[model samples]
Target: MCGRVALASRDAVKACAGVDRELTSPTPLERDGEWARAGGRNASPGCAIAAVRIAAVEADDDGASARLARATVGDRRACAIEDVVWGVRFDSRRGGNFERSFNARVEGLLGGDESTFAAKLAKTVNGRCVVYVDGFYEWREEGPKGAKTRVKQPYMVRRADGKPLALASVLTPEKARSDAVDDFPRREAAVITMPSAGGELAWLHDRQPLFLWNDRDFDEWLFGDWARMARERRAKDVKGLLQWHPVTTKINHAAYDGEDASAPVKRAVEKDAGSVAALFAAATKKRKVDDETAVQID
Candidate 1:
């Protein structure tokens, strides 16, 4: 459901993850300042990838200690800020392509069909990670379903307090082998998604990314046994955790990157609305559902 996301600054990501000073930036960012700058804005797979902070136990002079490091979606090495590919590659030996593995369903990861390749990998390897993003984009379909005249209105979802959101994700080595000769093996990551049964943002889509906004939540997701943890926390409510506002349609075009690409634009229907609170209230009350389903945390 999370097709596009906007990342925070490099320093912000490091601060959020509490990265150690000894850790260094990835090679790509070290050689190119522009690439690092672009990471602050809306990032699409292949063109730009968000930095992920990972924590692991390593053997050192002190025996075993937990350390914080960085890795992109598909980096094969450890303790380095590796630039991994965005989409999860399918194993070539299986004769399938890496087309739709970018987003992993929360149900699948939390004890679904284990016969699939992704489910098997998720169960075997604890590839837990925190994806730092300023916000994300979604679309709401207008008009009747399956109608030819249906139009999708773009919306930008972000914290109501305007802080960075730490999204929980799962990573895996690139499934498909690349022909290009690269020094490191490619890797890919998928944002874990849950059913958006109830929320202000439910109007936009039926699924939303699992968010770990605080330190305690992040620690549980990153280090704890998430499958068990998710079951225990399944009753928690996530409504009003985020706010969604209609944005310019320019975000639909991947090539379009204007100053207002991610900015909230006045909705044509509510152009004369006097205040933002009124607009948000209207959206919240538009489709009142009493039986709001609880969000499952994983």
Candidate 2:
């Protein structure tokens, strides 16, 4: 589930967006120092970070086109990159009391089930967006079953060609009561994830972030009919566009930041191959016995 991400700098975001003018809003800069310390490290949920999106702009004769913009949430306008909160919060009336809404499943979005959390956002034209990230982290577990313990072997997933990945995302404004005063909406965003059924990195996890690798994909993702687009293509089918490798475990600590945090590292094996094989064999034998006991009870 893409719980942690590394953001490109403001300049890198602009480069990806292909715009020269400053796309980030100035309001976030006026905040306290803590707020300013939001981006460019281990960006977890609730942290302020940079994202790229296309906002509808009015043209001559009331026509509009989707123009790329750096997006953040707290600003009055949705045109510039601002320091918005990461998770999308639904209205209390909607019965969405989720502790975290940072990753929206692609299946939930395109399942055509109106009851799903992402259904409404997926059908909306302006709800679509592309989040720019240098890379993201995922954990791989080791050891055997039952007695096995999961160790987070952090891995950095990035584009194979070294370009930044434009991750698919959805956005929404903070829910407020209809009669409430001073209830300005704070915009929030969430990354979308797809299943990793048959990919090389599937061993790391069963899910990966949905991303747009090139300009054509980016345009269709941000400006096309998202519901139809999602139905026609699955993100897992495009898994070849990304590459994943083991990285330092320092990323496990949210506060840890340095070049080494994302640098590729060799996996250090604590147990020899023989010991690992033995552990697996023992675990398999115990599992077979347990299954036989369960069948007899049934």
Candidate 3:
């Protein structure tokens, strides 16, 4: 299964470098150890990093395979889909950078137009979502699913409260992939900047933890809906630019602990280095029939 990590709070950036330091180093537990050793005051202990096991599940048929693969790519491609992630913005610019970054990774790996993927993704999932921008879990539901809105495909999504924002989806991955590009990258990378309910702040390299963010971006975003347009009409011009954390995850084997007899079981995430390494390995494993893990997008 695909796994991700996210940190909480605005000041979480302060702890990022330390996490990165352990990620790039030769040892695995060093990063987490360093953070723990630093104590709560030294680092923003509010950061929560959780790892999710995305089993390499196989589909039953062409439609199922297509759906599963598409959903995997689309969901994995878009960092916001993971359940462990939180604090994603729910405003109109919600999916902003996260969407584009996903498209870019797919395009770079699969060789297709990022816009095409974005457009398909726009159509695939709309409404039926809630976003947490402060690296915490929050929910809001609105919009239609599997149908086009008058404004455009992949429009900016807003939260019920009308403040935090993010790109949302009500459509299934199979539907989203029907219009998605085929050459989407098999490998991907992203970073989770926001904190999670677990209270840990750090960058992820592989199958370690689940934190939200890394799906918002400028190029792959669409905030030109009626609400935005109407707001633009009433006020001065506004520029919408999306940004994703440079933190990354990849698709490969060795990400999960396959060495044990029970290969499909979720692995432990005690050490940042070990878990992060596993995250990348899991990204590449082919979907098997057993790779089913449900995440509530709504």
Candidate 4:
């Protein structure tokens, strides 16, 4: 059996627009319509690669000046397309004034119909999308513990270009809710794991609005709070709530696969709060990221 691979090209922006069509070519007429659609072209097990564009906008600086940052890739180019791996960490947090931390829904990008968690999590497709947020179901349960989970997955966003706009899926519930409308809507954040300041696990990707929360710290808090709530029968609230699911990165070079590409990229961008444009630019050249093994995902 041939395994699917990921690929990225120089003209990624233009190429990604037609990614769905290329991947959707017809199969053999005998196998079905795939062959007829492809004019008898055989399916290749080669990895697929696509591209996305992240626009840069000006933000208000602490000094009250307007600062504009360029996009990650040059105007002619878009962000790098990488393959999805098990090591890239992801989490979704729900934080707001009106609802419990755990008040949100988590849905699969690919259709959910498997007995195993791994199968369910691997459903992300070209146009796969999910809507996550908190919900409250009241029933005949005793104490603060409700009869059902705090949230439900309700809405999803459309995938524009191939480069999945924002990856890190975090839903912050609104402070107030009404019986007429939905509560927490999705707010996209680019989720990447970078090494810690001391050179641990801090990740980076495009320069976009970011939420900084250490993976280990956040996971520990989530599990602890969830356990406490379950035991005390007082599911008062889950603090520092987040939400997220794994997304398949574009199939790229073999370098990012397996144990060989496991090392984390050193900080091209500093951990402190500041403008990342200059930092991102400096690092790509200064650190010679292109030569690095895990530079591109696919």
Candidate 5:
């Protein structure tokens, strides 16, 4: 499951879509008094990730400078970049805080019997969304020989060409119901993940975001019938086009975010001399992350 993700910037998503007229969604999670600048480089849950979705656009806001933010494709339906929280929406019936479901498994949605949640998402035209990110982080647990408690190494995964990665996601019902951008609804979403292509990528994690290859795929995923796509397992196979490597552990901190936080670095591993006790001791030393950082990981 993806716990954290990174984006180059909002401009990257616009460039990737090559679309016109963007609606600047200001949904209030700002740290520097700027809304667009929030959840930037190293983004985690609760952060607003930019997502492209088809929405009804009125004639006035089509080119007007209200936000000059979201792009427009036509007079009726247009592709707009929406601010989507990286997790499921809250349900009051649950009473206390309910951990949001951020990742949706393909097995439940496509591979095996379709899940009721996925089924509803598939049928809801407004629920489909496209999220673009630069890369995502995954941790691999390793041990120094025979240590019981293994240390985890972080890795950043991205396209080989370093282009924006288009992820398939489902949005909350409130996102696109309004035709205007100023409605400013606080929306949430979950990324759909499929089993990883079994080679080098399997080493990092067992699942990966369902990817859209190009503009054609973007159209199909957002408009095409979900059952057909699911039956064919039509998600673009990205096995050869992706590259990943070890990254620094600074990302473990909730406060540590920026381009440098996700930068690639030499692998950090414990050098073991073969003793079980020595191996266990070496593994124990890497758990230097503080309590606050650990909370971010969860």
Candidate 6:
């Protein structure tokens, strides 16, 4: 299960998510610690996480046409991002506690017979969104089931090409809770997952996040129909871009946010560190230049 995620900065996330600007973030990133400097190095469920989704702004025919015609960005150019809550309510049995789900299965979205909330949500543009993160944490259980000697080794999975991963997700149709998140009450969303394949990915978990790779992928995910798309597992194509390595188990505690917390404790993937290091350097430089640019896009 993917319990924790890490992100760079607001600007860096926007650049990677390819959005205009953050629409609403009621709670400021803390003034100090890793949450301030590096965003959340260890973000978990039931917290504020950045998500790019269709904004509440309704465009008329002209703006809608222009949005459809927008190249690369497509409809997402008009989309807005917010600090959305990270968990979705999957069940509400009488007298039972609500079940919060951090991950939703892609199979449910593809299922013709599924009447689950997540499956139904997959059919609407409003329900579609993406959570782009620096990386996420997964623990590999190494031993027999129920064995006392079993060890859980954690690994950080990020793009080998040094780009943030745009995880396919489905947002609940409406805000399911009355409680506020970051002072702005919001709907919940869960990252969609598919069967893991390609190299050692299955070693970590049988299910991996279904990530969108490029402009076309993002465009289709945000606007296209689910039933009309090919059913041969589209998410598998993005697996080659992923790489992972063991990190400090301190990440087990979601509040332990920092660069060092997510850093690889070992040199497992040859491309992992080199690409991530370069990406951080480039993100810093690009953001600096972007800050000074005279053209105001947003």
lDDT tens per residue, model 6, 36-103: 32247787676667788766434434455334534324755568777666778655786765677888
lDDT of 2 by residue, 1-298 (tens): 6578776666676677664443445223222432334445566775555665544332322123423222323222443353345667544645654465888888888776777666666555456666777888888765455645555678888888777777778876444545322322255678888777676567788887776666656656765555666555654566677887777777788766676777877753343456788999999999999999999999
Ranking by TM-score: 6, 5, 2, 1, 3, 4
TM-score of candidate 4 against the unseen true structure: 0.17
Q: By the lDDT metric, which is better: model 2 or model 3? A: 2
- Which tens-of-lDDT digit does each residue in 75-176 have in candidate 4? 222222222111112233546222112111122212244542322322211111111111111111122245353322111111222232222222211124
Please give the lDDT score for candidate 5.
0.66
Tell me each candidate's RMSD, in Å, in order. Answer: 13.9, 11.3, 26.4, 26.7, 11.9, 16.5
The candidate, 5 or 6, that scores higher on lDDT is 6
What lDDT does candidate 2 reach at residue 140? 76
TM-score of 2: 0.70
Choose 4 or 5, whichever is better by lDDT.
5
- TM-score per candidate, chains pooled: 0.68, 0.70, 0.19, 0.17, 0.73, 0.73
lDDT of each: 0.57, 0.63, 0.23, 0.22, 0.66, 0.69
Candidate order, lDDT descending: 6, 5, 2, 1, 3, 4
lDDT of 3 by residue, 67-103 (tens): 5434554233222222221122122566543221311
Give the best candidate by lDDT: 6
Choose 3 or 4, whichever is better by TM-score: 3
Cα deviation of 187, candidate 1, in Å: 2.0
- Candidate 6 Cα lDDT to native: 0.69
**Candidate 5 local lDDT, 1-298, one digit each (tens):** 5578885566788788765556664455553421233445557776677888766522333234222223332222367777777787444566664577788776666655545465456545566788888888899876666877675778888889989899888876655433323434466778888776664577677787888777766766675555466455533456578888777777766557766777877665643334666767766765645555788999
